[model samples]
Target: MTHLTLSDYDISAERGFLCRYDAPDVELHGKMAAVRNVAMALPKTLVTGRLRDLMLRDLPNNVEADDIADLTDEQARMAMVHYSFLIQAYVWGEADAPALLPRALAVPMHALAERLGQQPLLPYSGYVLDNWGLFDADRPIDLDNIFMIQPFLGGQDEAWFVLVHVAIEARAGKVLAAIPTILNAIATGDTDTVRVELEGMATHWAAINALFDRMPERCDPHTYFTRVRPYIHGWKDNPALPGGLIYEGVEAFGGKPQAFRGQTGSQSSIVPTMDALMQVGHADDPLKAYLDQLHIYRPPGHRKFIDDVRTQSSLRHFVEGAGDRDLTLAYNAIIQAVADFRSRHLQYAASYIQKQGKTSAGNDPDVGTGGTPFMKYLKKHRDETKARLIDA
Candidate 1:
């Protein structure tokens, strides 16, 4: 458990699962410099219906896999964040969704994706984890000081949507950092320590919920659905792409279509890590299956951290048998916290996506960005979490 600290996974105890490095170097060299410029212009070009045109005109071809691989891990992540937005915008930014992704985007993105062990599209890491920067270097990563580094249509709505998630990730750091201690306490039958840790986790969960409550402050639901949501949808199960996207000049696909899930909050490791800590389980279903598939979309170290937590945690079993009223109460608080968070998420899914009017080919109001009918499953999972509470 000692070896499972957040830093090992490129996650910061202070930043939770947010990027651990400084803002990416602004002055990229040669062809990549152009790529960076194109990526930066997306917020404007996408609205002007000229993103694809700009990419086609300026994006370089055959950015060697070796060159993409040569960048340090943080730089690679920054590149992936930019390339992912470019690829998504290229496909969905225009009116008619393009079936073929030019080698300019597909080739280097594939190589970067391979190097990072992530899907070659926008992922949770790119969306929230690595795609942020501080307004003030001396300040902590909070709603006031944090801003999105990369965005599809950057504005208050989009910025608020991302910053809220960033705030929650940073807020969860205390709880995440206490995992080893909680596990150790549970293993040692130190009910007092376990109780305190669980209570602390519950407190952090409350703060996280408060952060979640701010989603609607500046991010209008309709704007999120029509503008922000469209570019993030994946090719799989999406009618726009039908058979998926063809990645040109990438040897792995052999000129065939590749289907990868788009960026979704489900890919965020926060809830999954919490579930693992609480030993909560969702029955096998499409959403569950989809989630398991998304495990590969997370950074490799994060996947390991979640796996290790699930394997190492026996807190529920320990709490059930302890027969300590206070301990059971503390544990149940966390369960309720998880359910509460899910309940809010379910509400937002309906308002921010499900209930919104459909405006384009790829952005289906009924389907999540990750390509699932999420309403039913989200409710079901929330109910199941409530069922996990140990009754007195």
Candidate 2:
């Protein structure tokens, strides 16, 4: 069987998705400048009005199969990158009222992905796989190495929050690389190899937790809640967007509707990797279920990579060993912190989702408005891991 590399999917560009970050001549650049001017000079209502109009009028709404054929290779690539940032800003810039993304932006984005043979959204796996070499544990975290562009119109608070996830995703990439070795050890009953791999896994979790700890220093709570948090809102229940974001020409798998519930894009990435590491495989494990459903959001190769990791057994044996106390504690702390992170996101959702006249209640078995099941699983996993350490 052939394995996939990031280059196979045309995602190996050094700049990640921000290909237009330096492109000042693109039509999208002019529109972005206009939006920023309005944001700085106008009232909140006026800013939103201007942005909505710009989105509907300025951006390319109707994308067909032959659209990219008309452009040079570089032009097509820049168009995709430019539109990626535009979609993020249009959907997430407004705090209380995120505009429903029209076909102009949405269709072209989907078409761009199809043209490139990639997924519509920048899946977390792509970030990890494409940038695998940059994720050295010994190196200092560099904000510039992040996969997504710094929101051109967003503030420092927004930039910091995005960097934090970029750092965490780097750490996740390291963990993902080691998983096959750990699983190989488990399959062969190599306890010593398993112990070593588990230790490394714990270290990766610590690094992720450290990034979370640094969030306050980079972005204060006030700025985060007010500026950055609102951008991550999903379309679960807002009256304005009844069916959430609809990708034209994208059909739901298994005959379900092709609407996306509101979510922070990277939120689905790290926690699921940790959950797989600890083997928290309860029947109601929300992370596991969510990950299973989330494959559709990823490219085919990325989906295969995630599935390979999930199918492995949990590393519970290492916790039962006599010298694994620190590893156990580190593992428990990581799970707890992830659960806390999810809880905080829920609080943010509560404040914004319902205020827009959208139902915060989610009916998806994989995910809901409140992440109650995932939280419960994390708590149970943490307690059980601690108990095993004590008993050992």
Cα displacement (Å) at residue 323, model 1: 1.1
Clashing pairs in 1: none
Residue-by-residue lDDT tens digits, candidate 1, 249-327: 9999999999989889999898999899999999998999998989999989899999999999998999989999999
Identify the candidate with maximal TM-score.
Answer: 1
In model 2, the worst 10-residue window by lDDT is 12-21
Residues 1-392, model 2: lDDT tens digits = 13324333322223222121223233333433343333333223324545666555544444554665565544454555455545545665443344345556666667666665555543333222222223333554455544333243455766676666656655555555556676776666666676676567667666666666666566665555544444333454434345555554444322222444333443344455555666654454654465455556554544455555566555665555435565555545545555555554444334333223322223222333322234445445445433433332
> What are the per-model C-alpha RMSD values against the true structure?
1.3, 7.3
Query: Which portions of model 1 show Cα errors greater than 4 Å?
Result: 1-3, 24-27
lDDT for each candidate structure: 0.87, 0.48
Tell me the lDDT of model 2 at 170. Answer: 50
| Model 2 per-residue lDDT at 2 | 32
Residue 54 miss distance in model 1 (angstroms)? 1.8
